[model samples]
Target: MPVPKDNRPLRSPNEKGRYRRAWKESHGNLLLAFAGLIFLIGLAMIWASPPGTPEIDVDLGTVDSADQVVSLPPNVILIRVATSQLNSEGPIRIAVYDSPHTFGNPEQAIIKDSLVPIDGFVVWEIKLDFLPEQFAIAAYHDLDDNGELNRALFNAPVEPYGFSNNARSLVGPPTYEQTIMQRPTESTAIEIRVY
Candidate 1:
């Protein structure tokens, strides 16, 4: 099917104002109330969610490096996210752990970068809802946008990446326990560092 063109001529400021105000007064409150209802319904739907939901919540306050919410609510425990605005130079590092090592990777990693418009350096939060027990969480930092990590031609990952618990990177990706965590009830903060 052909897509419709939204090329209708622009409206005058006065015309726009009148139409917007009328709609606002007529539908604003109703819209808000409807949105509230929907949010509540979403929470309620969790009651029917699968039995594998994992509960996770953490509070890191406001991190200066990057802003992210990693914890999950009770009903919807599992969540997924991606980081972006990385400096290909050396800033493409995400530390799920500060000491042991970091986890995740940027080699053609999806989300975050593609979804956002960036400048200088920035990390985006890609909020996803899932059962805590359904999927594993791996937050990777990509130094470059190429589909694969830098290799020495020997095919070893040339970038520094880590998993949830510094789970060693085997052949492909790590397993759930290797990178998964108990869902958080509150929001947790993770950072994207450069290499």
Candidate 2:
């Protein structure tokens, strides 16, 4: 029986050789190119990822000579604040408030505020002035140095902020009552960390 003809285009006698040549020219480098692309993407991902946890130390110096020496009352308490997981972008701003009405407005309710510079990475300390019996603390890593906590359009904080008792909120900053820390002693130290 006679077989059908394919009716394809004419080809060279070394048809296999021609195909090999074409494949080598076009696709042989494709695998290598794809591998290079994958390697580049992986490098970028690694570079963009956050580094491991950091370690930090703080230095507490005497009060500035220019500041007046006011005599604190007997009820005045010395509160020491230690923070962890801090970034080195901006100074750490801490404020103590005596009332809930001023917790939301540090400018109005801040009994005493201090801006501590971040000399190291993850840990730092701030020695607060004499505080009253009832007080709450709010702190943040002001990455922008604007002296205010920055938030997104939805009011989500762009800066890393914390409160006494390490208070947190779902939609906004925590309330003063929620962050109040009371100690029976004359001096106390509170620790806060930011991820």
Candidate 3:
């Protein structure tokens, strides 16, 4: 037989089998150690993170259970949304905008909330401490629960939607100026109707 590439005598069949087993065991051990190291590093990074870092809760479902109770802060703005012709079951989504530039931009909304509708209405309680002096709200009945307002051709909304002050527009969406509401001194309530 030709010499082995390492120039070492070839091992007997039994020795080769034993060596292969030993190599696999050592390789597995190394992998396990590497995995442990990675896990420890992750734990250290998490421990070093700031205490104020917000925790994100992800819900895959369309609506949170109606029984889940959220304690409202002392300062809050309560929004009551009424829906007309709501024929399906899904969460109602609300977006609060703090500036004219962010109005109607879901990605830039200062606050976003979803609530399960009850008897054609949903209530959202938002903390007032961090909000600006003026803000606008845009809400929609998410009939499909796709996390967005479904649109038809020419970007016409296919779902029921409304803006603060019951604002409406003949062309596209209402301007931020038309829908803006001033923040109240104390906890206040506002109503929006989505058609």
Tell me the tens digit of each residue's lDDT in model 2 across 96-174.
7888777767777645455564443222233334445678777777777888878776666666667777777654667
Which lDDT value does model 1 have at 104? 49
- Candidates in descending lDDT order: 3, 2, 1
Could you give candidate 3's per-residue lDDT for residues 17-92 as a string of tens digits? Answer: 8966987978977888999999977865553332352333322123437855444446887788877644678888
lDDT (CA) for every model shown?
0.42, 0.59, 0.78
Instruction: Give me the candidate number with maximum TM-score.
Output: 3
lDDT of 1 by residue, 27-89 (tens): 987998999999867864553232342323334333444676443433332222222233344
**What ranking emerges by TM-score with the best candidate at the front?**
3, 2, 1
Better of 1 and 3 by TM-score: 3
